[model samples]
Target: MKRLTAAAGSNLPVGPYSQAVISGNLVFTAGQIPVIPGQHIQPETFEQQVRQTLRNLETVLQAAGSDFDHVVKVNGYLTDPAQLEPYNRVYAEMLGHAPPARTTVCVSLWGVALEIECIAEVIDHRLRV
Candidate 1:
């Protein structure tokens, strides 16, 4: 069975999609943008947006009974390729050793600077009945 999961305190979905969905041991998260709830604003700097996006991703993973440590793959989109260095710096710092396989690309985004999505392995103990 598949289950939809939403992170507590996270912003409501930007569209008709759940923050994450769990199927068996795998958790798939929808692309996370840097919009913070209540504020309705994305951070000013590219680095700040990257960090907020990662933090938002963390919330989705936790809601799915997983975390960055268990992420198996990551997909990131940046509006400009020039932002890659700063994005990498924050990503490396947050993921630390043994970071998951990642694919990042430059794409035109609407309003936001970047977006991030990931796949993670849900711990067996966290399976819901």
Candidate 2:
């Protein structure tokens, strides 16, 4: 069987899935919503929720021993396509030049404001989750 490892674990997963899984040299993270762990924020603003979503993704990556710079690809799901501008600004600000190949589309959010998923390739061959 292939060994699978997780990055981070909050109180509980909103759905029946993992926050992230690591196999071989690749790490894949499940979509994250804007709702903060252990703290439910309702009527979350678009900008605020987007920032929080990235923050959550960052935490997962860190826990997996891989940072944003190691990310090779990202899939962004925005409830509204018009939000691309604002989300792009925020993502660029945080990600900087380490922009991974990303594809953003408008998808009805599962249960929250924003959702983000990513796959990263850690440069260091020494680390294998």
lDDT of each: 0.86, 0.74
Report the poorest 10 consecutive residues by lDDT, candidate 2: 1-10
Q: What are the per-residue Cα lDDT tens digits for candidate 1 across 4-116? A: 64678787886778888887789999999998756889988889988999999998788778988899999999998799999999999999677999999999988899999
Residue 39 of model 2, lDDT score: 74
Question: Candidate 2 lDDT, tens digit per residue, 1-129?
Answer: 122234444424655677677778887888777767667763356777778888878878777667888999999998877899889988998886878899998878666656889998644555574
> How well does candidate 1 score on lDDT at residue 48?
90
Highest-TM-score candidate: 1
Estimated TM-score per prediction? Answer: 0.93, 0.84
Model 2: per-residue Cα lDDT at residue 69:
88
- State which candidate has the highest lDDT: 1
